[model samples]
Target: MRDPLSKKVVTIEPSGIRKFFDIVSEMKDAISLGVGEPDFDTPWHIREEGIYSLEKGRTFYTSNSGIKELKIEICRYLNRRFGLYYDYDHEAIVTVGGSEAIDIALRAMLDPEDEVLVPQPSYVSYVPCVVLAGGKPVIIELKEEDEFKLTREGLLNAITDKTKVLVLPFPNNPTGSVMTKEDLAEIVPVLIEKDLFVISDEIYSELTYGRDHVSIAEFPGMRERTIVINGFSKSYAMTGWRLGYAVGPAAIIEQMIKIHQFAIMCAPTTSQYAAIEALKNGDGDVEIMREAYDQRRNYLVKAFHDMGLSCFEPFGAFYVFPSIKSLGMTSDEFATKLLMEEKVAVVPGTAFGSCGEGFLRISYAYSIDNLKIAVERIERFVKKHCE
Candidate 1:
């Protein structure tokens, strides 16, 4: 009998992060530094609101575009934080998560073989989503010397006549690189000159250490070409709640909503209600979590340097991308051996993209104690292996 499978479904590779996770799960007493999830619980007030929604039987779907209140709150949050305004009615639609928002954006924008300029090492989803949307992903490697920031030259080099979009994953995953206003300003001309649509995944917006998070839309004449994706997941520790939103030009958002309406109908009703509370009263939680993460980041970078591993001191996001090249092993080998020897599970850098191969992404989302233990174990493992 012939196998039942669509070629598209069959061709897609499983996420490299999850594959290593499954392997790590089989080992005992593993201290995982690999996960990107916030270790903190959802803030009490936000949780309470979700509970209140469920109790009030607000379980029914509100609208294909999601609740008006949540969208309004998102608009306010965007304006207050980034000075990027959105017409909540026509320029925004709540999605199940940032993941869904990304999917919808790619599907709605790309025609078959259209090129998407994706900066890497980035979140693993970007290339696959581009492909699934019948678009070609042109991966431009972000260099360590540049703090993994997407360069203006790189953006310019990646664009071609077929280029239709640019997926901006910053503050970047794995790398923890946040582009500054000046940094983004450098790329503005390329976008306008090339007429490329931008998907600005700013999920780590609240986690920056020094400067306030800057959006590309904040640049002159670029708001009309940018889709800003943000959510309560990282900032509010609301990962499991699955709430996010996208804002863009009205025409683009309307097309995206059509895709989302047929595909998801609406985002979770209770999560939307909970997100309203998050937008209104959750700034404190963000500050608290960001402070904790900053402490961990300091500790982890120091520990890596002490252990003789070189790393760029991450300025944003809850991760440290340390070079594994000095260890004389591939990132996969380092992660696997560390898991076996020291019971520490870090993600291999290559999981993000080719540019990540010489590094290891160590998430600092765990407690300080766990971070200490993981670093100590890694030191021992590195010594034994390198010696």
Candidate 2:
């Protein structure tokens, strides 16, 4: 057979997270922590609303931009939470998930060979989406000593004439890092000076421990250039429902909606209705879940430290990235061996980026019992590997 794949497609690799997932599924009763999905179901009321919508024959596709009511709620929610507002009519579009918002944002903003500066170890999708959209991904390594946060200096260094967008993955995946408004202030002047656009992925905005999540859009001058990607997935435990939206200046959002219109007619109708419920009534649920996660965070951080793994205290999200260098194996090797030997699954830090090479991401989204079991197995695995 002739080489048939597009040149761009050939350069991509299967998600590194999926490799551990495949191995975990093959084992019996593996305590898996490789995925960032919330362990809770969509709250009962939210689920009921979706069922009611379906029963009412609200099964038709929504307007390509999404249901107006939902967008209005989104506007209210963003303004209430982060003090960032978008025009419900023109500055927002519902998408299949934050994933699609990411894709469309990249497509809408990137020209061939334009540069997208991404901080690593961030989400797996950010860089690849930039590539598929015909842009270059410039990954700036976020250091563990900085709590895995991107520093202002690194941000300044990574910028060049071709840099058009920066993917700020705060409340970040894999590392459980978050940027406070004070933390974000350091980068704002650099962004303004460089005239860069920001694609802020804030899906974990509600899960922060000490402070409320802040949007870059709250900064002066940044509002016009920042596209915020948020969803019902992490905050409302609606991951399977696949509802998300991007809010930005109408000009950029209009362009994104055009790409979204052609690629996905609309997000799931039932999910949109459910999301409206989540937005209108789900704040209590988020608080309840966040409390539970906080308990687990405290427990797991202690557990990791007791086991001789140095983990940056996770300030947000459900994951904790612990350095595995003490075990004298690569992060991938540690993750692989833990699954094989102890039936425990975690994602290698290196899966996120090269800066993550000697770390491992352990999600604490599972029940405490399951987390304890997984950590015990990991402790045993590390001791055995170390010996």
Candidate 3:
């Protein structure tokens, strides 16, 4: 019989993050910090809106781009919070999630062998989506010494004649690294000079500490070429709601909608209604969650420090990427042994990228009490292993 699967699909590896998560699910009494989900429930007002929509029988599909009110709300929300702007009628699209927005944007722009610069460690979806979309993904390994922010030299070094797009995953996943306005200033000129377009994933925009999350699109001349992808998942705790949106040049969003309309009729109608409420009145809820996450983040950093573990302080998102290089064990080896002996589950940093080899990505998105317990287990394991 002939081969049934496409070689392209087969060549892509499944998400390494999920492997440990699956094991922890089946392991009794295991404390898994492997997932990146917020422990908070979707804010009450948002849930109420979804219920109201259902009661009103507003369960049908929305326009392929999204409901007009929701789009307008998204624009207003971005402007109020992050100082970015977009036209509701032309430059916005509602997607199934930020993940879907990333996928469709790559599909809309990439042609075979068109190079896309993907910085790692990042959200796991970028490289595979680039491959499936027929783009050659060129990885730019972000350095810990640089706080994992993409640098001007790195951007210039990665670009070539074939390079067309750059995936900027910021207020980043796994590493919790965020790009400030100054950091963005350094790279925007290079992108403009190289004539490279950008896919800026700003899903964690609301979670940054000390400084605000800066959008590449907010810089001069970048608005026309940068696609900003964001969603209700991390910020609103609306992951299950499955709604996200992209705002970019009308030309790009139009093409993305063409793909979105056929592949997905629209984002879920009920979720769209819920997200409207989320965008309109959910700031307080997000602030509360962000504060809680900030506390957890600080506690984790201190715990690692007290135990003599090497962990950089994360200023955004609810994760801490701690180096396990001192333990004389690979990330995978440490994570596996920690799970087996200590009954605490964390993802190896290599799950995010090859350079993540000596690190572990532990999420602080759980309760303070759970975090304390996980810390105790981890410290015990570290002492045992280090000895």
TM-scores for every candidate against the unseen true structure: 0.98, 0.99, 0.99
> Which segments of model 2 are wrong by more than 4 Å?
none
How much is the lDDT of residue 378 in candidate 1? 89
Q: What C-alpha lDDT values do all the predictions have?
A: 0.91, 0.91, 0.93
Error of 2 at 126 (Å): 0.6
Model 2 Cα displacement at 306 (Å)? 0.3
Ranked candidates (TM-score, high to low): 3, 2, 1
Collision pairs in model 3: none
State the displacement of the C-alpha of residue 372, model 1, in Å, after optimal TM-score superposition. Answer: 0.6
How far is 108's C-alpha from truth in model 3 (Å)? 0.3
304-332 per-residue lDDT for model 2 (tens digits): 89988898998998999998887788888
lDDT string for model 1 (224-319, tens) is 999999888999999999988899999999999999989899999989999999999999999999999999999989898988889898889999
lDDT for each residue of candidate 3 in 187-223, tens digit (9 for 90 to 100): 8889898899999999998998877888889888999
Q: Compute the lDDT of residue 339 as modeled in candidate 3.
A: 95
lDDT score of model 1? 0.91
Give the backbone clash total of model 1. Answer: 0
The collision pairs in model 2 are: none
